[model samples]
Target: MVTSYVDEATGLLREDGKGSAQFEEVVLHPRVTVADASMAEAARAAHATAHDWCFIARSVNFPVRHEATVAVG
Candidate 1:
């Protein structure tokens, strides 16, 4: 899932240094994910309605930079 999202973002956003002097991450979320045992629907719904209001997102024109991976079972 993380790979898919990264690939999709690569298409939507310039890969790293395609623009500007250079690109560097201002923040990194190390442990965020969706899980089967959690309230996925509620989380999705609330996030959809509230995601844009995030201070970091509103502050930057570039996409948030982070890497997320699930442990192989």
Candidate 2:
């Protein structure tokens, strides 16, 4: 799984303006290698389950998007 994000800040460079920063978006790329192509759906489902159970994902106010890929080896 690879995680990437974008951060946005407002008024940070100004001498008199207050600085605030927050995540604009987060993306999770989950790759699964399975023995057969038929298992791709299961792999994707598992990733969804894991994401639902993740505390950090649930706690974050920003959007957490998933890009799941499955490979048959």
Candidate 3:
């Protein structure tokens, strides 16, 4: 899940007429799974790569941060 906090004073306006929007903060939660313990480390590393490759994330100038969990099921 992803979440963002918008400044209420702006009334959810997209911009200040300056093309700059108000996004107080953004948080991302991503979950990854691996087949076994041997692949756990690699799966964790892949998460970073996946984030880097996200088009929306890469296109945004604002910082996009995440809290991720990797599990073997």
Candidate 4:
């Protein structure tokens, strides 16, 4: 499962009378369920690779953080 958290703050209004907003922070929470506990490391590695390849993560100017968790079931 993957969850995205974005923090935004309102910016100064423009002369056109429009409100502006900017992203302050972005956090991704990825929960990986593996068949075995030994796969935890592999799952984490995969998550890292995916993060690196993500277009949104790369396009954003602000930092994108990850809070990943692995569980065995």
Candidate 5:
């Protein structure tokens, strides 16, 4: 989701404004699966750790955060 500020006179988004027409907050919902139910906790931890190592997330300037969930079946 994003929040943008528009120029009412020009009827255009203010690119230079504080909250310009840009992707401000990006939420990532990553779903992980584990073979064993007992390993669910480990899978969650790994997912969390993986974010720091992710190239795409690291390359982005804006906030690329997540609300992750784990499942086992």
Candidate 6:
């Protein structure tokens, strides 16, 4: 996720704009599994919750991306 932001900042990800940054959603690692669907859903919920706590959300110069890691047991 961080990679995506950095990439955009560095012009790795570009659209019509020459160098533009945008907000993006970062998905959890596919390794995350679910015995029940709720497990993965729970992890996603927690991740989304934690993202609100990050300082990067305040950054305006660069696009912000969050990394989600779902644990599999």
Better of 1 and 4 by TM-score: 4
* TM-score winner between candidates 3 and 5: 5
Number of the predicted model whose lDDT against the real structure is largest: 4
Worst 10 residues of 3 by lDDT: 1-10
lDDT of 3: 0.60
What would the per-residue lDDT of candidate 3 be over residues 1-73, giving only the tens digit for each residue?
1122222111222567877867544557666666677777776677688778878667766666666676776
TM-score of each: 0.34, 0.63, 0.58, 0.67, 0.64, 0.36
Over the stretch 1-73, how does candidate 1's per-residue lDDT look in tens digits?
2211222232132355656453343344333244442444544454444445668666876656433333221
- How high is the lDDT of residue 39 in model 6? 71
Per-model CA lDDT versus the true structure: 0.42, 0.64, 0.60, 0.66, 0.61, 0.47
Among all candidates shown, the one with the greatest TM-score: 4
- Model 3 residue 22 lDDT? 76
Q: Per-residue lDDT tens digits of candidate 4, residues 1-73? A: 3233233323332244466556666777766677777777888898788878989879977777777777777
Encode model 6's per-residue lDDT on 1-73: one tens digit a residue: 1112111122233365767655343332323444554476776676577657656655545444545555444
lDDT of 6 at 50: 61
TM-score of 5: 0.64
Clashing pairs in 1: none
Q: Rank the candidates by lDDT, best first.
A: 4, 2, 5, 3, 6, 1
| Candidate 4 residue pairs in clash (backbone atoms < 3 Å) | none
Candidate 2 has its poorest 10 consecutive residues by lDDT at 5-14
lDDT per residue (tens digit) for residues 1-73 in model 2: 3232232322212233456556766777766677767776877798789778878778978767667777777
Please list all clashing residue pairs in model 6, or write none if there are none.
none
Give candidate 5 misplaced runs (Cα > 4 Å). Answer: 1-20
